[model samples]
Target: MSLDTPERLPASLADYQALAQANLSPDVAAYFLRGAGAEQTLRANAEDLAALRPWPRACKDLRGGSTACAVLGLSLDAPLLVAPMAYLPLLDPAGEAGVAAAATAQGVGMVLSAQSAQPMDHVRAEGSNCGWMQLYWLGGRDATMQLAQRAARAGFSALVLTVDAPVHGIRDAELSAGFALPPGLRAVNLDGLAQPQFAPLTSGESLLFDRVAHVLPGWEDVAWLCRNAPLPVLLKGILHPDDARQAVQAGAAGVIVSNHGGRVLDGAPSSISALPAVVAAVGGAVPVLMDGGIRRGVDVFRALALGADAVLIGRPVCHGLAVAGALGASHVLRLLLDELEVTMALTGCRTLSDITRDCLGPSPF
Candidate 1:
């Protein structure tokens, strides 16, 4: 059975979080909430945003405030996009399809994870032609090409290649809780794709670096993958400016400044902290987007001011999905857009272009 729509809908991301926690089981909540190791990077991701103070302006014409922007030729009503997250079925049976309906209704883009519970075709058919597919180089070159082709055929406009995780991070919280994939859900998109198989380890070999490293793709492989994809390719999980430049050079159409939502590398720098250098490095060569620690409309404003072409939201989307099906997800998007509009009006910014660096104070970091 689906959850009841609360009398007062969630007005803030924190509200959604609390509601989601109350509705979902302990293991499901842990999968979404906990980060790798001690979660230092997770804490830092939010803390960095809290450190930045917006310099709001007053006494200006506010009649024309709008939150519209175009990224990589996709015109969105707001700069907000949903980040690709796996196993939406873990939250609700609707999964990626529910998200698509919500995103389409709200006029925003949704990045469907390759590790999703539903097939790309089914998810695409649900709603939102403004969808992008997130690809993981899981089964090597041939498998990667197959998934990209599938996404294109399924009407996905863009391909997001996640570069941060060659292997899963050490998620201690999930590990300790024995957080296994629930019985009914698995990566349905990857059903027929070839999967990597490793030889049995000898007595003394290291399990991580020695065994797993053999199957991982290198930087050169990234170029090859970019060349092969039919859709515009964006490299996600990029932090360093040098890597940003390299990605553009390697034919990446865009780069997302993310540290895997602080879920991949425990000590990695916050996406907000890394946004400036990467944006400067790209220098308008390609679009630079970001995702991590985006809760309030002010956080979205901060990211745009710091030089991101757009921003992606992760946990909040899941929070909505957990609380209600399609309705909850759509409501979350609306809340964010509403808050962003209010922020723009209050700050005397009339449009997306007006949300510039000058609107911000000096970075605390």
Candidate 2:
């Protein structure tokens, strides 16, 4: 059931997700949808977000309300950013390039994955000045530094170091379906690069510590990256308050409170659940951002009310990409922004700042 031009664009984010699954092959859809282990965290991400209720304030001056915000000195039409998601080529041949063009045109920021289908320069050209790059600590210090330099040269304003996935998660759905990356789809930016590998697991040695641990970078490496990198470095995949504190101490310009979208460490806490603590831990030293299970405009308002500076939207954008390339992706963003503005207007909040904790249900924080 391919969505044609008229039917391709969805009126809601959830519709986009459904249409994307309908259009993509089962293998690809499973690859995109699977979460790690038993998926407790995956379910929890949406559940926790749903638990948050908004308190509507009626009868206020609603003449000239705007959803614009400034994050890291960059003006955004809405306080929404496209999270760094990999393998856009799997969704459409236009890949990250198409998504980048849409994001730039929509006046939102985008973060290209370290594992993006296109190279840094091409993605940057497509995304224009609003593009940021998400980095994985590849192999060792030198390769990581080289990637950073490349991104800097490509004019990425910020560097997002994804610290959660030192190794891929145990995705049960992908395993059950025997899903594999299709031929011709590769992380183009990492072409010709040597990734760290580990020896076969020895008897009695845990797969996590013995195999995965070998490639993981430590806190000192994170600190070194902060000092050496040319751009502001943000530590993504941070959940714990302590880790958030450590990231700030290591000179991280910001922290993205995420559980790797519940794709890593399945039983791990939901990102929204972890966000408040991380926000408290940072204590305003650095901006705290969050991602995961953001499906609606009210969810965005809830996230901000819960102390997040901004929120990154992931799966919905991918859904849009899968459905109608740039058109679908940009429309998804526009829908969210439009919905957010409506939520603001109805709630009597004229500005993003007016959306404070009091606007939400009683907070545990």
Candidate 3:
């Protein structure tokens, strides 16, 4: 069901987290909760959010206040979109539909994972028409083009090319939970590949790179992929400003400044910390978005004020879905949106447009 006749959602973002935590199972909680290895970047994501203190001002108009912004020609009611996550069936049966409904209720976009259990068409039909599809680029050139065409036909407006994960991350938690993708819910778009593979994680001394080196995309491959996609292409898993500049130069319409939420790489820098430099590289020529430690609307506020045209959320929404279906997911989104509105009002920013660089103090990083 959709959240059409909503009677105001949760007051605080933490309330959603608490409610969701109670509803989720052990595996679901761990999968959404843990980062790779030590979670240095995961912890740092929150710390960095706190660093961007909002410098208060004498409010001109607090009454006419809300948080809404436009990114990459898509007008989102908030400067946030649901991040692309795989296999929601593991958490809730509704899967992509639940996420789409939740995002729809919030009047924002949802990035549908290529690794989703549901087909692109089913998920596409769930929410508003702004759903984006993230592609992993299997079967090389011809197959990639076919998949992109399918996404466009399925009603997705944008293409999020995941460049970071040539293979899967070093997910110890998934391994321990015996988190294998069961037969019932394989990637619908990638049904009959001979050898489906995620990126090979580099071992400390295990020289297995040669075997899987063919899977990962170099800058040249990125350039080629960007040229082929019909929709606006946004490169995900971007960290360095140089890479951000490279992405834009390679014809990437946008870049998501993410370290895969510290999931793929063990000790990479936090996504939030990388935002400023990457935003500088893009020069706002293209929309620069990010994901990774967005639990609160204040985090949402922090991301946008720090030059991020938009932000993507990964864990919190998943947590909500795990707990309840569309209900929990909608609740989580409502909490964030509500808090963001309150934050804008208190900070003297009348609307999302008023939340500029000047509203923020020094980045503590």
Candidate 4:
């Protein structure tokens, strides 16, 4: 059942991406590659990620291997998790299932998107025993509660409530490429009437978001989400320091410092750039994680050194899936884990605990 054979391809993340780029279509590439709106935050996600470095300690032993960390109370074999990016059915018919298979093979879990091409239940099936639901809260209490109950019934272990995208922002590439999730492929959990303000603005006039806009949830809804959910809830898209504190107050189990991969707000700080203050605000009351422009194993180390309890990956895994289905996805994950382990060994950090803020160089912010 193994889908990995890195022997025939790129040994590092960069090399794998180069191969993936040549194989993927331009529009598909642009969707994953381009940021939403102006993409200012998207660029910062990568630039800020590159700015931090881990300080290595040479004398200590590392044969014991890398640190396995947890988030939102889930014990993961590694700190990496697949961030929820919708429309996998477009990339490969397997969609979320493909991502789930690859994630399980790599000994990790994947957050299945509510906006998935496949139904959340089917996506959960692909990631069953290792799946978590990535929610963008729905119309009203009954609607939101219904999905939550279904996810719990489907055996989802957690909930990642995305707080960004209160309104679907402008995505230039999605517009330029003429991309829109078709009606047949609309988010099954969020169907409703279309509206002018929240409606898709393309020439195609895709009613994707419009049909579902009435059900969008806010802070009050977040509390309701956590209350009715059976498992831990991780509030994704947390940026402001106060938001982090408020999330803890609202009973969120954790927070992912994400800006929707720069797909929502073009001017927000990189998730990595926003980590420290959020971590400080929560003051260790809640676990803080991040996702955005994380393409390298070293990027994982950099995020950890900056005080992120864990990190999430977006484009690269999609690239892997797009290029070779499940096998390609697994390859990308394994490569990242291997790189993280190597860095941990070389830096004399043997456990996740050994990777602390002290190991980082001066703050880039």
Worst 10 residues of 2 by lDDT: 1-10
Model 3: CA > 4 A from native: 1-11, 63-66, 193-207, 362-365
Candidate 2: residue pairs that collide: none
**What tens digits encode model 2's per-residue C-alpha lDDT throughout 193-250?**
6778877766765765877776788999999999999899999999999999999999
Clashing pairs in 1: none
Task: Please report how far candidate 4 places residue 90 from its true position, in Å.
Answer: 1.2
Model 1 Cα shift for residue 281 (angstroms): 0.8
Residues 1-365 of candidate 4: C-alpha lDDT, one tens digit per residue: 22455356666667657766787676776777688878899899999888887777778976766566666666778998998888776666777788887898787768888777666666656665346788766656666666766778887878888878777678888789876554677666555422223544555544565555565666777876777678788899999999999898888988999999998888988888899899899999978888998888788988888788888888888777777787778889998998888888877789888888887767657
Q: What would the per-residue lDDT of candidate 3 be over residues 158-216, giving only the tens digit for each residue?
A: 89999887655787775676655556778886665434353455665344565457566
- Candidate 1's TM-score reads 0.95
**lDDT comparing candidate 3 with the true structure:** 0.78
Model 2 ranges off by over 4 Å:
1-9, 362-365
